[model samples]
Target: MIAPADHLTPDALERAQRHLVAKAIAEFAHERLISPERRDDGGWRLTVPLGDAEYLFDAVRAELDHWIVDEDSIRRLVRGTATDLDAQQLILELQPQLGLSDELLPLYLEEIASTLAGSMFKIAQGGPTADALADADADFQTVEAAMTEGHPGFVANNGRIGFGVSDHAAFAPEAGRPFRLVWTAARRSSSHLALGAGIDEEQLLSGELSAAERDRFATRLRDLGEDPADFHLLPVHPWQWENRVAITFAPDLARRDLVLIGESEDEYRAQQSVRTMFNTSHPHRHYVKTALAVQNMGFLRGLSPAYMRVTPAINDWVAELAAGDDTLRDAGFRVLRERASIGYTGDVYHRTAEPSAHRKMLAALWRESPVPLVSGSQRLATLASLLHRDGEGRSVVGALVRASGIPAAEWVRSALRAYLRPVVHCLLAHDLAFMPHGENLILILDEHVPTGVFMKDIGEEVALLSARTLPEDVRRIVSPVDDEEKALAIFTDVFDGVLRHLAGILHVDGVLPEIEFWRLVAETVDEHAAEHPHLDSLVDLRADSFAHSCLNRLQLRNTLRMVDLADQSSSLMYAGRLENPIGRARIPQPAARETVGG
Candidate 1:
């Protein structure tokens, strides 16, 4: 918990506050929550609801009609009075525009505060410039930590709600320190392990835990009035144990349904997405995704027991499909699968047919780490890294282009073909669409050029657009998606949610012209369409513009309550359709014919 730097210093705090204010202003505007008056310089200005306060910023209206604002140009004024930018007050000023309910406003403020603090911490833990990262051969963890912007869509992305300032300093991924995980024992009757094909309990336990460590865990269970064989061990996030499990699950502990075993000897580093931990101690061990009952981004991040039971089989189904496909095999697109999962159902919580955050409280899954899949010549970086910009305004995307020694557009084309083609193939050929956000996908770099991609973090959001029956084992993932909302998965999630920001970043960086950038994206989709015509005609319709489901609006509406993950497809809130930039780019505008003289 050592201070990364002078995090509390006035200059750092002001910078963090101002940065968030700018993001909030731009995001709210883009959501159509507010309309700022256009200024003569082509920038925009806003007077707060109370005429006492106002904000002025330079911004450009970009594709998807996003307000790409210049952070440095932001100015805040108050009652003919002014101070260095204040985000806390800005939240109150935009309260009407955001339309936050009274009950949720205070809680939302906490998220905003935590988010601002995270930005402050990042400022404190400054690292290599984008130029340096672009040129250097950085390891996965090194490059992961360098990523500055947390979720481009959400302004308050790092709101680790349950954490105190100290907890944030210790466990936040940006802290960049390894810590031991606390282990606990759940009685066999209270918990269950869902094994992957050919993976038994013994092999699973021994792989993640050494013999001596297993003995230690078993002995601790025996010391209590329980047989070691009657209980299964579960790893809990250290912060969760200290703040949640020990306090909230005390009754389970008293009945010996859950017993506190000591921390694991192996140290783990928190990955970019906070709850998932990378096994730093054993380089090739499975990455453990744990259930932390904290609100992050839009919902409670607790892993559902009902959902956990089916992860491995779903993953196996995906892997099997990929192996059988010639195009996917040749494309080199691989999924970093969730191979095994274990869940502990508290007797009280399991009484409910549906899963609330309470039922989701204690569970963990083991995702296959990219470590073993990685070779020495090949490197890995999260796709999110491309969005990172250093203090000098150089983007990681700019750096990667330079490092690859390829023309910017050429590098982008290869990266797009590697990423977009697989996603498109899965949709057209298999009726599957993954959650294609940055953190969910890993960039596979061979000698600084993106060779392929590894898709991770596929859960309920991986939609099945088809009504056709699936295998008995994998049927859990096959949900009926309406035609209207089917393309929203790819269009909203991939095109608008992810590529919108990427296009803006690259466009601003001058790495690619805006039209050419979008043209490449359109071309990639058209090529995929040309290759796969046998699947469904809807592919062309989906590739063209589709409905825009407003994701941030869902969070704003229900900040505290569970978004009802059980009925996930129904939970989305839509603000009407956004014209797909790539779709429009792909359509042919008829050429004008020359007139003949009489």
Candidate 2:
């Protein structure tokens, strides 16, 4: 029950505030949601609603309308007196301007506070500088841990909204605390377990839980007057069990429908996405993502029971496609499938409540870890890590590029093969769209040079945009969508959502000029278009431009009431169209090579 006081030092707190204030200014301005007047001194002034209060900061409105705001140069002026930045005060003052309704005001403020606190926790640890992280020579977790920023565009990215100070210390991913998960036995009648091809419960349990752990769990089940054979076993994040499951689903526990089976023998560490835990005890084992039901960003961060039914099938379908397609195989595109899953649906919640409300409270899925699949000396890092700046402001990607011993332009072509090629091909050939976000995509690098990509977290995120003909088993991946919106999955999700920030960071890091970066992207797209002429019927690159969907605006608009998100394309908020970066780029042809990675 100890608080994370050590991580929340005054210096760290102040640094967190300054960092987040910079984010608020950058994101709001970039989204074109706020109007800031340019000043003659090269500083921009954002006036407060209904008053004389103002915020002034030096920033370059760069490409894609990115606000490259300088953190140290930001200040607030009230009645002609200047003061240091305060994130909470800034958000409060801009609440009306942000269009944050009264209903979402208080919770939004709490998220901002939690985000700042999490940032401070990361800062207080005198971790490796960005230069060191760029080296890419550290342990896997060390490199992952060194990522200072959470979501690039999200101002309230680290909002672990459910955690108390004590919970934060014990369970926050940045804490790097390794602990055993509390296992459980849920009656088969009350839960659903889905397994992919050639796998069963015993196979999964044998790999994840040792014989001794299984026996111990069985004993706990027997002690509750139940046979282990009649129940399915699942691991629960200890903190989640204590804070949410124990209290929220007390009826099931008391009725002996869900029996506690003590801690597992294996240890796990949380990934940056708090609900998902990587099996540090066995690196090659499945990564278990559990439903914690914490409200973060805009809505409850819970895995849906509805999705669990088709989870394994969806992954299997996609994995088979990736393996069968010569293009996907040639590009070395891999999907770390969610091979198995178990979800609980309580009668109380099933009949009385919305599935999203309570049926989503308890669920877990096993996604194959990339460690075992990694070939040669190839290492895996989340795509987000590219933008990761260490304490000393060194980028992870910059270090990787430097280590490759190749020119920035050459290295970018290599990177394009690994990252962008697959995405464009996936949409054109397979009629599929992976979330394509940094958190969802893991980058595959060999000797710190781009090789290929291994994607995970598939069930809910990957969707079939054009389901011309799908196998009966794989039909679960299809989401109801129109042609125009389906195309945005590529445009908005991959290009603007991820590559915009990546290009900016690489430009800032001297890896590749932003123009050249987009040029590479455009070339990759054009190459894919040339390769897959038949898929021209499925998609069109000739559409003059695409919608610049507003991600922050979706959260702000839905903060009060989240739209029932049936599909990624269904509930969208587009600010306006920024001209396609790809269209503007003068495409470049690679020197003749056997592979794009060369």
In terms of lDDT, the poorest run of 10 residues in model 2 is 584-593
lDDT (CA) per prediction:
0.79, 0.79
User: Which digits, one per residue and each the tens of the lDDT, describe model 1 over residues 336-419?
Assistant: 878788789865768777645787778898888887897868888899887788866778888888888889889889888888
Candidate 2 differs from the real structure by a C-alpha RMSD in angstroms, to one decimal, of 3.2
lDDT of 2 at 341: 91
Q: Which stretches of model 1 miss by more than 4 angstroms? A: 1-6, 79-82, 352-355, 541-544, 584-598
Candidates' RMSD to native = 3.9, 3.2
Compute the lDDT of residue 222 as modeled in candidate 1. Answer: 77
Candidate 2 per-residue lDDT, tens place, 527-590, comes to 8876765775456543557777887787777663345566556577777876666654334344
- What is the clash count for each candidate, in the order shown? 0, 0
Model 2 off-target regions past 4 Å? Answer: 1-4, 469-473, 541-544, 560-563, 584-598
Which residue pairs does candidate 2 place in steric collision?
A: none
